[model samples]
Target: MDATTLALLIGAGLVGGACNAVAGGGTFFTFPALLAAGVPPVAANATSAISIWPGHATSLFGYREELRRHAGRLKSAAPAFVLGSLIGAWLLSVTGNGLFRQLIPWLLLAATVLFAIGPRLRSWIAPTGSGTLPKPVIFLIDLLVAIYGGYFGAGLGILLMAVLTLIGLSDVNEANAVKNALATIVSSLAVAVFIVTGIIAWGPGAAVLAGAVAGGYLGARFARWINPRILRAIIIAVGLGLSWIYF
Candidate 1:
């Protein structure tokens, strides 16, 4: 890759990592940057998936305290997530790219709407959870979300957060922690598939990975320092901006 392309990839990685750490729309930045840098759409998507793995790992580590607190739930949910991700990744590989490309813009729009009204939706669903949701139900939701994550991870965290909220996780921090860990798991598995298929662009992947790690670390730390309302506003703005771009 040329120096200019490398630089753009790195820059996009920084934005992606930070956004992912904070609000989960990093692909909205990195994917476009990759396309602009002349990577084919399918290759760019594959490469971006490989690059963002480190960011997810960093974000999950940053939320280790919250993860520890919910270890039991995570353990219970792991099988579902793993199974779902594998299925999702396999489906993506088997399905032709044409369908995914046609579907993505609409998916982004739907995800954006989900993010925009998620809180209100949570409130509406709040009363249904006076008691815990059955483990089977939770597992099914996890599996479904993991499938979506493996297929086209844009705005996945928001979808996970919504599911978690409906299932009785009222604390945003805890929800975010779970979202990060699950996303990390799904992305890691998906990357493995992409790499095995020889779809990843290693040079750009390495550059983006470096930037994502740094940005994720900083963003997670900054998240702890910021006010929740401000953070929410920023996340919503970023989500809207991404939606516009994708649309």
Candidate 2:
């Protein structure tokens, strides 16, 4: 990549990591930066996944207690995470560029809309308890969302939050923790798929990874000091701005 593209990737990675650390829309920045850096659609998506996987991994630290307490549930959710991710990555690999491009605007729009509705959706989906939804239903929902994560993943955290919220799941922090943990699993599985299939653009992905790590670390360190509502507004603006670029 040229200096310009490298800068773009790094800048996007920085902001993307901070965005996710603050709220939940890093892909809104990273994916578009990959595309702007001239990576193909499917490859950009794969590389974007690879770039952010580490941040997801690091996010698990905050919820260690919850993860430990809910070990059994986490174990129960693993199969769906792996299976759904593999299937979604496979679907992405087979997608034609033309079709994928056509879908970009719509996908961005969907993610934006989801982000807009995040607060309300969270309230609506707030879990009542385990008895609220059957295991099978929860599994099915997880599998479907994992599939989507494997494919695109821009608004995945929001989707997971909504689903986990609906099952009358655990506390807010626990739900967020579970979401990051599952994201780590599913994104890792999908990364494996992209690696085996050779769809990833290692160069840009590596650049973004470096920046993402730095950004994630800084964001985590300063999370309490930062205004998430401000970061969220920036993401909303970027999401809207990027939608037009793909068109």
Candidate 3:
């Protein structure tokens, strides 16, 4: 790759990782960067997944205490994440580029809408006097979200946050911690598939990975200080914008 393409990938990764740490939607940055750098569409999508996977680990470090408190919850959620991710990744491996391309905008729009409605949806699901949703219901939700994350994870964090909230996780940072943990599982499983399928572009993936680690750590540390309302607005706007462009 040329120096310019390398620089672009690194820059995109940095921004993408920080975005994921803050409010999700990182793929809006990384996926397009790869496509612009001349990678094939399927390869770019696979490489994007692998590139951003490590950021969740660094982001998790910033939420260690929260993670500890929620260890059992994460453990219970793991199997669904694993199974769903494998299914999604397998689907991606078999998808033709033309079909995948046609699906992109719709997927982004749906994820964006889900993120926008998440809090309200959670409130509706567990209105006053009602307890948190049942464990089985939560598990089903996580499985569905994990499948999407494995396929195209731009707003996976927000979707996971919604699931965590439905389980009665009130603290934003704590919810983010759980979100990152589950995301790690989803992406790791998907990446393993991508690796086996030989769809990832290692040269670009490495460049993005390097920047993502640093950005992820820093973004996580700063996340708590930011106003959640404003962050969500920015993320929503970005998601809408990206969806529009893709359409």
Candidate 4:
């Protein structure tokens, strides 16, 4: 890769990692950067997937305390995520990306809308009470969400948070912690599949991996110091900007 492409990869990774640490959607940034750098669409997606794994790991590690507290819940969700991820990865490897290419813009648009109106949705759902959602319901939700993550993974975090809220996580931080852990598992599994298939481009992936690690660490540290409302606003703004460009 040329110097410019290398720079773009690192810069995209840093920004994407920060966004992921805060709200989750770093793929939006890195994927476009890869595409702009002249990588093919499928290769870019696979490369972006490989690159973000470290950031996901870092973010999950940063939430270790929360993960410890929620071990049982996380365990309950893991099997579903793993199963879904394998299926999704297999599907991607076999089917090619024709369908996903057409679906991406609409998926991004919907994800953006959900994110922008997330607070309102939370308010609307609050009165219904989460006590009614059984464990089976939660598992089902996680399974479906993981399938989506395994397939594309752009806004998986947002989708996870929304599902977790429905199942009774009132604290956004706690929900975020779970989201990160589950996302790590799903993405890791998907990346493994892609790597085995030789679908990943190593050059851009390595650069992004370096930047994402640093950015994830910084973002996690900053998360402890920042107000979540402001963080949410920033995430929404970034998501909107990406949607405008990509959609």
The TM-scores of all predictions, comma-separated, are 0.91, 0.81, 0.93, 0.89
lDDT (10s digit) by residue, model 2, range 111-217: 56666565555555544422355679779978988898898777676566556656655344555567778888888999999999999999999999988877765
Residue 161, candidate 4: alpha-carbon lDDT: 65
User: Over 4 Å off in model 4, which ranges?
Assistant: 115-128
* Best model per TM-score: 3
Give the CA lDDT, 0 to 100, for residue 57 in model 1: 88
Native-to-model Cα distance after best TM-score fit, residue 84 in candidate 4, in Å:
0.9
Per residue, candidate 3 scores C-alpha lDDT tens digits across 76-142 of 9988999999988988888899998898888777777877777777788778836478888878988
Clashes of each: 0, 2, 0, 0
**Sort by lDDT, best first: what order?**
3, 1, 4, 2
Tens digit per residue, CA lDDT, model 4, 1-247? 8898889899999988877777888888899888888777777887888898788888876788988988988888888899988887767776556776876766666666776665566566555644435667667877877777777867776667666656666566777788788888988999988889888888778988889988876776667666767756665676566567666
Per-residue alpha-carbon lDDT of model 1 for 136-208, expressed as tens digits? 7778878988888888777776667667766667666677788788888899998888777787778777888
Q: Candidate 1: where are CA atoms >4 Å away? A: 119-131
Model 2 is weakest, by summed lDDT over 10 consecutive residues, at 122-131
User: Where does candidate 3 have its weakest 10-residue lDDT segment?
Assistant: 158-167
> Candidate 3 — which residues are off by over 4 angstroms?
none
Better of 1 and 4 by TM-score: 1
